[model samples]
Target chain A: MAKTLTQEFTKGLWEEIAPFRLVLGLCPVLGVTTTVENGIGMGLATTFVLVFSNLLVASLRNIIPSKVRIACFIIIIATFVVVTELLMQAFAYTLFLKLGVFIPLIVVNCIVLGRAEAFASKNSITLSIADGLGIGIGFTLSLAALGSLRELFGANNLTIWTTPTSVIGVQEVFGPHFQPFSFMVQAPGAFVCLGLMLCIMNLLGSK
Target chain B: MRELIKMVIVLTVLAVLSGGLLSGFRNATAARIEVQQLKFVKGPAITAILKGVSNDPIEDRFAIKDGETERKVFVGKFDDKANTVVLESFGKGYGGDIGLMVAINMEDDTIVGAAVTTHSETPGLGARAKGDPGFVSQFKSLSINDSFKVTADGGRVNAMSGATITSRAVCAAATEAGGIYQRMKPQLIEKLKEFNK
Candidate 1:
């Protein structure tokens, strides 16, 4: 029943990936994956909040009353979310604009609260940190994968990152002749893509 | 009993700590955030409206006191004369307030150009106000004193199809800009004189 630090971390990458495996925190996973840049930005923001909140909640687990634990967790989570929002606005203003409401909405991300409740509250600080990092990186990888898939088929471009002056990505990824499946970038496309990914994840796990 | 006291203490301490941390971070990052907003959000719109100006509209800016509120005005220099000013105003839209930056020529009192700075309107419909230039272009060369209204309200400007509210919000903002420009003209002239020399 005991998970070593390595196991705690690795599980998040595959066995308990937030979006694909655990199926938690789909709001951002579905919303901000329009571009790989967006996905990475959202994932990192969530990761920052997750790691800090987990650290704080685990450290304070002894002091937090069972009746008021959820409230305490939210306060800690919300503070970090705001910090992420401010930092993003100050530094990555364009990404901040693209992500918009989702950054503030990170406070309500089930993954953060879920980890705080189920894992961090009962684990050692080192274990909790490993879990946070593992899950955070897993979420980031999942988002980037989805974003690249969607961006490639939908926009026919893979926007890895956007700088103030230039975009660092492939243009006309399918050699300009291939028509973009524009639907893959729409709201409905997000659902279909996510569903297909979930199915593929299930198929891969079964073996 | 003791459990209730513990809950209160725990919740209070957590809440207070979170508040203090957030406020400190906010204070530290507030100035940088403003610069970022100017560079990304408001800068493009200001540049678009002040096209062909001899000076950087974003750099040559001044704040004017209107009653209690101080409004930042961007100055545009055309052919060596600082005769145009852009003022930002907001109009209530269906989703939220839409920010409009309206530029006015001081000599003729006509609108030079107008652009949307910030908005939260519905995409592809209300959001077209920012994306598509056709709707905002109607304000070009029009006198600032003229009351702006869409066809539905019996004004000259035509509203974008399926976005009447957003169009009206933009019109309202332009009209509000006129009011502010007129009210601040004397002080604006004084400020423009400083820029001219």
Candidate 2:
């Protein structure tokens, strides 16, 4: 059976979700998802880079030689990453500061390059855009969910963005009486949370 | 072979195009990026330390040559007099350099307040250098000549639990800020004089 264009798009959301299902871009998923806002911001930034890179790669697929394709792909992807970095610095400097090296590290994010190589390089531009959107939204939602979980359990707060008086940008998810399970915000917690989520996903997928 | 030449041409064109697009975008957004950085990341820290300043320290800033790099010094005016200036300092931390900002009351050469700006310390441990305000608040109202060391090192300041190294680094940065203020006193004072005119 021939897969339709919509399949290429929709599949990224659940079946081939980048962070959970595909496990393609787990670096930002773990690193930036400490707060819901950081996760959403990182996700959107990665999506911007992914969409443009995919579109450009697919459009230039014919002209790019097989021998130099990887090099070409890197340059294209890096260009978008820089664009994302500058835009984030200009508009979202707080998030940019919070994200730090991870923003520049997006140049090496396997998801953008993977899509360019595996999907975009061979697919049509329209299809590539759809794939980018689907995958980007999936990655974003996954990050937000993961971040919300961590923020809820780890700090007893869900910090979406800084409010005027709050200064620290956190909304108490539970009452002040709740003692935060701080471990959920650390490295081990990231692995455990992601692992548990993956297990749950597998259980659902198997059924 | 002709294939080699074709590959070279393709790569060169791609590089040039990518380079051109990036440079163009960077040039367009450079000013806005700087303003955003000052407004968001550094502004809060500056204001936090210079709590009573009437003027916008982010805007009332000047740069001076510090070694090979130009260091930006923000001026905080109280009662319309630029008698205080905030400057940044760096000290070696467990992971790397810990950046801190110290606001100095030029009159008595005392620290108004200090805040950690950046660090690469462990998140839940050493990162308290930035996260815990009480750690930095220890420097408030202290004379610049006072040794800014952790209590473990026989100084008045207390180190964060399990983050003694980071605490020491922050104290070192405050001490560095004092040194910078002393060295740059003449210039900073002169600059502040002009601001009042």
Candidate 3:
């Protein structure tokens, strides 16, 4: 039975939610999630790459030989990543620099590659686009949530972005006198928070 | 043989297509990207260091050929005369290269200001090099002839607490900038003539 387009789009939000249910692409989730802004920026950039690549892969699926498909997919994905990189550098230089190597690393992000191979390669172009959007948003939301949690606990405030002449985009979730845990923004804290969140998600899903 | 030939042709076509697309994008966004870099990344640091200058440094910048690379130097103008030149230098840091922008007063051969433009130092530690103005402010008014080093190395500047390595990196970058200034002094003096009122 063929799944409906809406189902394909909606499933990624929860059933196949990346970094949680799917457990795909944990690098940026842990790395960039120290701040909500970084998470959002990284997520949107990934989403752009995912949608275009998925569209291209699905439309060319029949013509792309199975033996060379992986190579072809990578080339297509790399092309989109380059375009995204240049555009971000031009328009969002601060976010671009903050994201650093992660932007270029999006080329190999398993989420993008996974969609290309598992969903896009076999699905229609329209379906693939839906899957990309669904999965990308799911990933973005997860990153933002994790980032906000970590930032709140670690730094006593949520850092949105730092600009010249002002440290803008930060909100004091905790009072000024509060001594933040601080470790929540570090590497170990990322693992602990992500692990706890995943456990909670599993507990809810099981019930 | 047929299968291999087909694969080769397919790969070659994809390469050509990707190459063309990327080059087109690079061409389209090249100028904008340069401006963006200066505006958000380097511009703030230059402006912070070159405070009180009348002309916009970003618009009044020029690149000078230095060895094999063209170094873009932002000029600060006062009363319609260029009086300062800001250049970037890099030093190896904890994670990677730390980029430092050093502004020089052409009139007195002293540093107007210095700031860290980019660094990959650890957050709350070495990263303070970029955030802590006090750490960089020590560079102000220092003679270009002075060896820019942190106090740990018997120099006037103090290292950011718990970030000595990063502190040293910034100093190293400033030292290099001083060297570049010495080498380019004559060119900079001649270049300033263009902006003279």
Off by over 4 Å in 1: B1-6, B64-70, B91-97, B122-126, B134-183
User: After superposing candidate 2, which stretches have Cα over 4 Å from the reference?
Assistant: A163-170, B48-56, B62-73, B77-81, B84-191
Write the residue-wise lDDT of candidate 1 on A91-151 in tens digits: 9998998998799899999999999999999988899999999999999999999999999
Q: What is the lDDT of residue A196 in candidate 2?
A: 94
The fnat scores of all predictions, in order, read 0.98, 0.90, 0.81
Better of 1 and 2 by lDDT: 1
DockQ of every model listed?
0.83, 0.68, 0.66
lDDT of 3 by residue, A121-165 (tens): 999999999999999989988998899899888887776666545
Q: Is candidate 1 or candidate 3 better by lDDT?
A: 1
What are the per-residue Cα lDDT tens digits for candidate 3 across B1-197? Answer: 98888889988998899999999999999999978877787988988888889999888888898888889998998777789899999998987899999989899999999989877788789988898899989989999777788888898788888998998888889889988889888888888888884
Cand 3, B chain, TM: 0.83
What lDDT score goes with residue B4 in model 2?
A: 95
Candidate 2: tens digits of C-alpha lDDT, residues A1-207: 456789978988998999988888899998988888889889999989999999999999999999999999999999999999888878777778789879888989999999999999998899999999889989999999999999899988877776334545566667889999889999889989999999999999999
Best by DockQ: 1
Task: Say which docking band candidate 1 falls in.
Answer: high
Residue B184: error of model 2 in Å? 9.7
The residue-level lDDT of candidate 3 at B106 comes to 93
Assess chain B of each prediction and give its TM-score: 0.86, 0.81, 0.83
Best by lDDT: 1
